[model samples]
Every structure is written in C-alpha cells, then in structure tokens.
Target: MRIQRIQAIAISLPLIKPVKMSFEEVRNAENVLARIETDNGITGWGEAASAPTMTGETQGSMVAAIRHLADKLEGLPADDIPAAMHRAGQYLYGNNSAKAAIEMALFDALGQARGKPVYELLGGAKRMRVPALRLIGTGSTAGDIAETQKRLAEGYVAIKIKVGVDTPEADAERARAVAASVKDDKVLICTDANQGWTPDEAIRFVKGIADTRIEFFEQPVAAHDVAGMARVAAASRVKIGVDEGLHSLDDLRHHHQLKAALGASLKTIKLGGLQAVHDAALLCEELVMKVNLACKIAEAGIASAGLMHLAAAIPSVDWGVSLSSPYLADDIVAEPIALSGGYINVPTGPGLGIRVDETKVRRYTREV
Candidate 1:
C-alpha cells in the first residue's frame, strides 16, 4: 500500500496541574497529532509534544514539517516503515518531533496492515505491561510530599522528585520528604534536577541525602556539560541518569566513555523517532547499561501508545516507563491508557492499539 494523505493538528490541552521544571512551567500540552491514510483506506494515528529546551523543536516547526512532508509521502510504500522514515528525513532537517510524529503514524499503519501490534513489529514483546512513575515538581516541599503520598495511595510505587530549582539545602529537604515518606513502603524515589544544579551542588545534595533511599540522580548538571556530569557521578553515591545530555550517538559515546551515568532517559522526539530510539537502546545495552523510555509530559494517547510498544520491545528499557497522559485533565482518545498498581497494560491490538477520539481532538485543537 502507498500513502494517500497526512493530516496534522495542533492541540493545547490543559494539565490537571502545571508542571514546573528548572527552566519552564507549562500549564497545557502543546502537542501535534498526525493521521496517515493509505490508498487501501487504513489509517494510523500519532502525536508529539515538542520541547525547545529538550528537543529543540516547537509546535509550529512540527506542524510545518508535517505539512511539507505530506506532499513527498504520498507515494511511499508502507510495507517498509524504516524506508518511509528515511524518505521523510529527506524532506525535513532537524524537525525530529515532526518526523517522530510521522514515524509513529507510519509504524501504526505498518502494524495494522500486518495485523500485529507495534511492539510485535519492533520485535516480539518482552512484556505486556509497563509501570509509570509520577513526577513531583519543584514547587512546594509539603505539597510535593502530599502529592507523593497521594500517588502512592493510588498505587504508584515510584516517584521522581524535582531538585536543583532551589538551594542545595532546600532541594535536599524536598527530596527527603518524599524519600522519607516511602522509607517504610516498597517504593523508590528518584531525583531529577533537570540540569538545574552545578556539579558541586549536585554532589552536595546527593551527599546530604546519602542516608535516604533516593535510588538515582537524573540530569544533575547542565545538559551540555558531560565533564560536569562525570564529576558529579564520581562524587555522588547515588547513580546518575542522563536525560537531556544524550542528544546524539556521539553524545552517548562520550558519556559512556567517561562512565558519566549508569542509565539514560530516552524520548522519541529528542532522538528522532522509534528507529533512532531502538538504536540508542542497543548502544546502551552494548555498554551493559539500562535506559528509561519516557515521553514528553501531557502527550495524548498516540504518543503514549508508541512509547508503550517501544518499552515493551526493547530489553534495555528495563527501567520502568512513564505514562503521564492519565494525569492530564483530559485525553483525546476514546479509551484512555489505564495505569493500575503502578503498571500500564500495553495495548495488544494492531497499530498503536488505542483509537483517537476525533471529536475531542477537534475541540482541543489549537490555531496553527
């Protein structure tokens, strides 16, 4: 089958609560959704949440790239999704989020045509369910503690507490509250400084909480500072995980050589798309390291489903994945992803497995 049409939309879905990282606070999910239609009448859906700070992409760029590529994708054969990605790459440069959105749709189409789930398309799935870890913002310590307790009560066992937005002492206290709260439970806490701390500050904060159960430190230093990351990793007892730092294969190689981190957080938009994500996970495995397959926050069902399939197929993504769509005020899918006992059941149906709620998507669609 060949491509017939590609439709794209930009949606601004409000968050249940604003998510504040060290750099920006977002109240709504600025996401782009895409649907690819084949000549045989089968269609597949995809979504993207771009981050200028992380993926160096904005919603406008994603929409523009999708519109530009639609003309070129009209006749590409859908039997080989990787070839579709390569052809899409030829029409756009550096619009990974845009390309990722299209790749997701292509994979969805391929899965449906083959009567297999996207995970099965990647490789036979290793798991049928994946766990989600709720993230705590850098707003209030007491609030953060209460939120952690609330999520735990709702069956979440892992929480990522934001650090580095405050002073070293204050960040320690913020993390301590959540770590201490889970001390008696079978839960683990992770600290994500979002590259908000200096190497010295990261060392100090981790040392201060050295007695707590904080499992790992994520992006403690700046994204571009691999040397600082190495220094912080060397100085801290808690293992470090890189997020924004691993933007390219060379970046991964550099960090691996320095032994800067034990694991990395991979996102579809930042690395290009599923093909690139698969490559990165393999590289991590080559180094005997783990990877946390995560999505941009507030992604709609299409993006979430893509991540679930990827996490299911990749062995090194043993680190639990996060599905933040459930935390949104609303989702643009007929069947929202279900998270129970900290685990989300992967969709077993063909394509992304979740169906888009087009009416809701239209209501949430933002002006281009």
Candidate 2:
C-alpha cells in the first residue's frame, strides 16, 4: 500500500531510421524508465521521455528528480496519485516529467492491484480501435513523395508531413508534391512545423497551401508566442493545432482564451503523465476543442500503451494520434504492436496490456 523503493533506468535505444522534425532530428531515443516497488511486493513501471527542447528536462535531470522524490513517496499510499503529484510539484519546481514518471508508476501499481487496465481505471474505453496518422520526415522531395505514396498504400489514410526545415517556398513545394503524389482526395494531409517558422512566415507559408486539401497545420510558430499563434490562426485558412505550447492545463486555458489553437496535440510525457493528460482531455471536451494524441520519440512500451488508452478514452480526437511507430525500433516489446487498417487495437489486460521484456531493457540500459 505504501512505496518501498523507486528505481530509475536510463536507456538509449537506437531508432531504425533517424527521425527528423522541423525542430530537431534524433537517431536514438533516450528515455528514463522508473519502477516503483510497494511494501506488498508489487512493482509498477513508468517511463519519462522528456524533450529537453520542450519540457526543459533531459534524461539525466528526470532521473535525478525521481530519485530525489523517493523519500517523500516512501510512506505515501500508491492510490493517492493527486496528492503525490501535488507534493512533488510543491517541493520541486519544473519537474513535471519526473513527477509524471512517478505518477504513472503509481497508477500502474493501483491498476495491477485492482486487476484492471489503466484506461478502465481512468474512465472506461470509448472505442475499441484508435485511429493513427503517419509522419513523413524531411527527406528529399522525391523520396518524401514516394514515402507518402507508400504509407497510403499501406492503409494509412492520414499523413503528417514535416516542414519548416527549409525556405518557405521550398517547404511549400515539398508539401505540395507530397499532396499531389498521394492522389487520394480522401486522405488527410497535415503539416507539422515544429515551432520552426516566424509568425509572418508561417502565415505566408500556410496561406500558400490554403488552396490544397490539407486538414490542419501544427505548431507553426514558436512555442511561446501565444500572440503570434493567435495572429497566425486568425489569418491562416487552415486550422491550427498547438503541441509544444500547450504543455500544461494553464497553457491550454491561455490558448483557449486567445483562440490560438483550434485543436490540441497532447502527449503523455509533455503533460507529465497519464493523469495530467486525462485532465487535459476533459478540459478540452469542456471547451469544445478538438484533441489530438501525440507521442514523444520514446520507446514503444510506455508511449504506445499510454497513447492507445488516451485515444480510446477521448471523445473528440479528430486528428488521430501522432505516436512514433513501435515497428520502427530494432529492439522493443516481445510482440509487436502492429497497425491494421490505419488503426491500432486497444490493449485489454491489467494495467498496460503489453508486457515489457526486462531482459531487452537491461541489454539497452546504460551504466551511470
């Protein structure tokens, strides 16, 4: 019933292909995994895939924060997740990822103890299959066009193309090429700028693509520029979805007031953990804003399960999920979480349905 120990592991898992977004390119996923042990001998697993560019915490800082909070969590009841999050936040400033990691472990422990999946514990599932979207990296125009065609052929109806890595004209040309290559009018095309454009530039770039069938544009301007976001959203013909900007509930409220974003891209790690993400989803519903579940460039184990549960519970996730493909990793869970017909089946077991291969985790664990 009470916490006994908190163990943190830092692993660097190589990606099958280097993932490039407008803001950064990554070859390996560095994630901080935590396991919390209870006095009754139950162990719960969690992961913090912090984005130093986004959350201001790297793998090292997140692990240290988890270890620092070990004493405070030792005697606390694992079921009191809200209380734990409050205590962690009150004592440590800007450690959302660390708090999220621990909070996830607590939820996992409670779910396992009660013999229920995490989604049922949060709220019952709303759908059996969650729709997903594929991300096309910043490859050559010809290569990216081919990739988009390939993904469409593979049953991915929705595709998000990475832009903002080059000149506005160049990015627009690439997007136009991909849009043209797919040749499916029903396919949803979205562009992620990854906070790479200036407000004026974003307005111009998005305006150029306004005539196309693109569904929405994500994080075009800098993450902190709410005013710029408002300006761009107000001027652009396409709807805007904010990702890095709406990291917290307060941030969501601010964007709502500004009318800066028509949709929100919520990620498990960015909100700190699942509970925070759940709170955000509920808030978005209350505000009548569309929600989109996004992913960190983390391992498949926690990210895949967390996103599946999130997309299943939310009512208005119109843009689908932007999770990294688990199939893109050389080493991951024992059974691959495959995509079928552009959707993923929600897991139906205790806690997170997928089991983690501890041996594989150990093999990738880095010595500190």
Candidate 3:
C-alpha cells in the first residue's frame, strides 16, 4: 500500500504523580502522535513524548515538525520505511522525536499489512519477556527506601534511584539505604543523575557509595562533556552509564574510545526511532556495553508497546527495561500493557498489538 495521509495530534495526559528529576519535575505527559493512512484504507499510529530537557523538542515543536515532514513523506511507499526516513532527514534535521513518531506509525502499518508483530519486522524476537525496572524517588531518603522495599515485595528485579537533587553525600546516603533494603543480591540497583552534577560532585557521590551494591551510575555530568564523564568514570568503582550524552552511534563510539561509560540507556526519542535504537543495541553488543531500554518519564501505551517490541528483539538488556505507561494515570490504548510480577510480555499480534482508543485519544488531545 502507498502512503495517503498523515496527521499530528498533541495531547496532555496526567501522571500518577510528579516525577522529580534534577532539571525539572514532570507533572503531566506532553506528547505528540502521528496518524498515517494508506491508500488501501489501513491506518497506523505512532507516538513520541515531548522531552524538552533531553531532546530539545517540545509538544508544539514536535507537532510542527511532523506537519512539515508529512508533506515530504506523502505518496512515498508505506513499506519503504528506511527510504521514507532518509527523505525526512534530507528535508529536516535533528528532530528525532518527531521523526520517531512518524517512523513508528509506518512500522505499525507495515506489520499489519504483513500479518506479523512489530518485533518480527525488527529482526524477530530474541526473548518474549523482560524485567520492568521500577523508579524510586519519593523526595526523601526514608520515603525512597520505603518505596524500594515495596517494589521488591512486588517482584521488581530492577530499580532506579533518582539522585542529583541534593548534595552528593546526601544522595549517596539515600542510595545506600535503598540498596541495603533490597535483600536479593540479584536485584539490579541503578541511579541516574540526568546531567545534574559537576564532575567533582559526581565523583564524590560515587566514592560515597563505594561500599554499596549499586550496579551503575548514569549521566552524572553534563551531556556535552565527554571528558568530564571520563573523569567521573575513572574515579568511580561503580560502572558509569550515558543517557543524555548519547544521540547517535558516533556518540557511542566516542564514549567507548574515551572510556567514558560502561553502558547506556537507549530511548527512541533520543535516537530517532526503533531502527536507530536497534542499531545502537548491536553496537553496544560489539563494545560489550550493557543496555537499558526505556520510554521517557511518561508515555502512553503506544510508545510503551513500541518499547516492548524493542526489548524483545534487542540482543541484551542487562540493565532492564523501563516502560513508562505504568506511571500514567490513564492510557490511550484500549488494553494498556500491564506489568505482571515486575515483568512485561511482548505483544504478539499484528502491528503494535494493542488497539488505540480514538475516543480516549480525543479526550486527552489538546491544542498545541
């Protein structure tokens, strides 16, 4: 089927609670959706969260970018995702979040036409289920430790502690307390600073937590300073990871060459789309870096479903997957992807597998 039409819809969805990061507090999910229709009357949907701190794309900018790209993509072959994406890159540059939305919709449509799951389109599934990483940041040490215990009791195999808000020593104490609460040695404990600290501060934090079982520390310094990341990594006994620093395969290679990070947190919004994430995962395997697949702080079921497929098809997920739908008060899919015993199963049906509820989409939709 040939491409027919494309439209961008902006929405604001409430989060269950505010997620406090170093740079900002997320009270609601501001996202953009791409709806594509083929000449044969089949429709596909894709989504991207507006992460201004991470991707430099707000909801308004993403909507405008998609509208500009839609004109360049219409009449192109719907199944030729790569070619269409190349065309989009030629016309627009560095709007990965907007392009991710368009690319996801194309994959959904192609999978439906081929009678296969999206994972199959991404080179088939290496595994059917992945452990879901829970986030624990209740704004206090006592509250964070309590939440960590609750997550462990609920069977979460991985958990991430939000730090970088307080002094390095204080955050280190909280990380220690939370790590001590998890009796299971196999449970993965990680932390993300979201580029909230100076290299010296991050070094101090890692040194303070030297006695703990924390697996890795992520994006401690700024995204632009690879040298700062390297300095922190050298001072850190715990493995270091990159989140904001990684935008392309070249970035990955640069980090590896500089010994800046031992692993990375992969997000579609950062890399552009599913295909780009897959390529990054392969490169990580070659470099022997651990992989952590994640959706942004708050995405709905469409983006979460896309994450599940990538989790299933990626070579490895040593750091686990962070699916964001669970953080939302409600989702736009008819059947949201629910976590069971702290794990998620990949959707096995055609296209994205979950049905989009147009009614709910409209309810959440807002003018950009």
Candidate 4:
C-alpha cells in the first residue's frame, strides 16, 4: 500500500515517580510520536524520544522533518521501508528521531499487513519472556540501600545503580552500600557512571570495589573516549558496558576493534529504530559480545514495545533488558503492558500486539 499521510504529535506525560539518574532527574516524559497512514487505510504508530545533545534531534525538529518529507513519502509503498528511509535521509541532514519514528511506524504497518507481530517480521521469537532490571538512581548510601532493598522485595533480582554523580569516594561508597544491601551474590548488580568519570578515576573507583560483586560498569568515561575506555576496561575489575559511546553499527564495530567494552547497551532511539537495533544485535553476536536492550527514561510506548520484541528475538541479550516499565502515571495505551516477576511477556497480537488508545493519546498530545 502506498503512503497517504504522515502525522507527528508531541506529548508530555507525568511520571508516576520521578526517576533520578546520575546525569539528571526526570519528572515528566517528553516524547515525539509519529503515525503513518497508507492509502489503503492502514495506520501504524512509532515513538522517538530524543536527547538533542546525544541524538542531535529535538521533538520540534523531528515533527518538522517528518512534515517536510511527507511529499516524498506520500506515494511510496509501505513495504519499501529501507528505500523510503534512504529517500528521507537524502532530503534531511540528521534527525535520527524523525527517521526512527517514521521507520518504526512503517515496520508496524508491514507487520499488520502481514498478519504478524514485528518480531516475527524481524526473524522470530527466541525467548517467550525477557527478564528486566530496575535501575536505582543516585542517592545517599542509606537511601540507595533502602531503594535497592525495596526493589528486591518487589521481586526484582537484578538492579542497576546510578553512580558518577559525585566524587570517586562518594560514588564508591554508594556502590559499596548497594552491593552490600543484597544478601545473595546471585542477585546481579551493575553501575552506570553515565560517562561521568575519567579513565584513571574509573579504574580506581572500580578497583576499590573489587571485593564487591558488581556485574559490570557502564560508560565509565566520556562517550567519545575510546582509548580511555579501552584503558579502563583493561584495568578495571568489573566488566565494561559501553552505552553513550556506541550509538550505531559503526560505533559498535569501532568499540569491538578497540576492545573498549565487554557489553553494549543498545537504545532504539540511539541506534535509530528496530532495524538498526537488530543490525547492532547481529554485529554484537558476530563480535561475540553481549548486548542489553536498554531504554531512555521515558514512558512505555512504541519504543518499549519495539525493544520488548527485539529483546525476545535476540538470544545473546544475556544481560537482560532495561526497558522503561509501564509504571508511569500516563501511558498512551489503554491496558498497561504486563510485567510479572521482573519480566515482560511478549505481545502475541498482530503488529506491535499492544493496541494504542487513540483517545488517551490525544488527551496527552501537545500538538494536533
């Protein structure tokens, strides 16, 4: 079916509870939603929550780019996604969020037309349920320990604590407290510095907690510091996971060549879309490295659904998913996607399987 219309909506939904990480505190989620309508009356939805400094696209830019590309997309076949994307890219510079939003919607449309979930289209499901880890944000040692215990009591076996907010000593103390909170060593604990530390400091801080069981360290130094990351990875006791640094297939390959990281945190927005994420997963497998289907601190929408399907299909995602849970006060969908025992069940319906509640979405929409 040929594309008929492309629409973009910006929504700001309040979080049930503010999530504080190493870098910043997030209250409401600002997400740009894209919807594509085919001449055959098929509609598909996508989400692209941009971090302008990271992906170089803001919500306003994403909307404008999609609107400007509407003419080119109007007559294109929905199934010619790669070609359509290439055409769109030729016209624009770098609004990856805009590109991802359109691409995901097209994939959703293709899945619906084929009478299959998106995962079925991208290979097939390798696992029924994907385990998830609760990310504990930055706080004092006592507060951090309390939060860890609370999440553990809520049946979350794995926890990722935010560090690098303060000095190395303060961050180390927070990490140590979190590690000591859980009695079981099997309860996996990891720390994300959010590229807050220098290479030397990362090594020192990670080594200080050598006795504690930290599964891995994430983005120890700045995103572009490949050589520094390699040095830290070599010297640190904990395994290294590159997050902000590796955004694309080339970035992943570059990190692999430099031996900069042992694992990668693949964010859909960062990589652009589901296709990009799948490509990254295959590349990770080829390199014999682990990948984690991660999320930005946003409400559950198309992005969450896409990652859920992607994580279920990839067997190498051993580190579990760090997906944004549907625990937000306002989710765009009618029924909250279920999470049981710290794992989310893959949707089995056609397309994304999770239906979008148009009324709810409109209520939160900032623009028509």
Q: Model 2, range 69-97, lDDT digits (tens) per residue?
A: 88877888887888878888877887777
Model 3 misplacement above 4 A: none
Model 1 segments more than 4 A misplaced: none
Which model, 2 or 4, shows the larger lDDT?
4
Q: Write the per-residue lDDT of candidate 3 for residues 164-250, one digit (tens) a residue.
A: 999999999989998998889999999999999999999999999998999999999999999999999999999999999999999
| Top candidate when judged by lDDT against the true structure | 3
Taking the tens digit of each residue's C-alpha lDDT, what string does model 4 give over 1-368?
98888888888788877877656777877788889998888899888775665576776887888888888788898988888988987888667777888888898888888899998988999987877778887367887888888878777778888888888777888898889879987787899988888898888888877888988889989899999999998888788999989777899988889999988998878887788888899988989888888767784667788778888777567777887745478788766667787777887777887788899888888862
Q: Candidate 3: what lDDT?
A: 0.95
C-alpha TM-score for every candidate: 0.96, 0.96, 0.99, 0.96
Q: How far does residue 150 in candidate 2 sit from its true spot (Å)?
A: 1.1
Pick the TM-score winner. Answer: 3
Worst 10 residues of 4 by lDDT: 50-59
* Better TM-score candidate (1, 4): 1
Q: Residue 126 deviation, candidate 1, in Å?
A: 0.5
Which regions of candidate 4 are displaced past 4 Å?
none
C-alpha root-mean-square deviation, candidate 3: 0.6
Ranking by lDDT: 3, 1, 4, 2
> How many clashing pairs per prediction, in order?
0, 0, 0, 0
lDDT of each: 0.85, 0.81, 0.95, 0.82
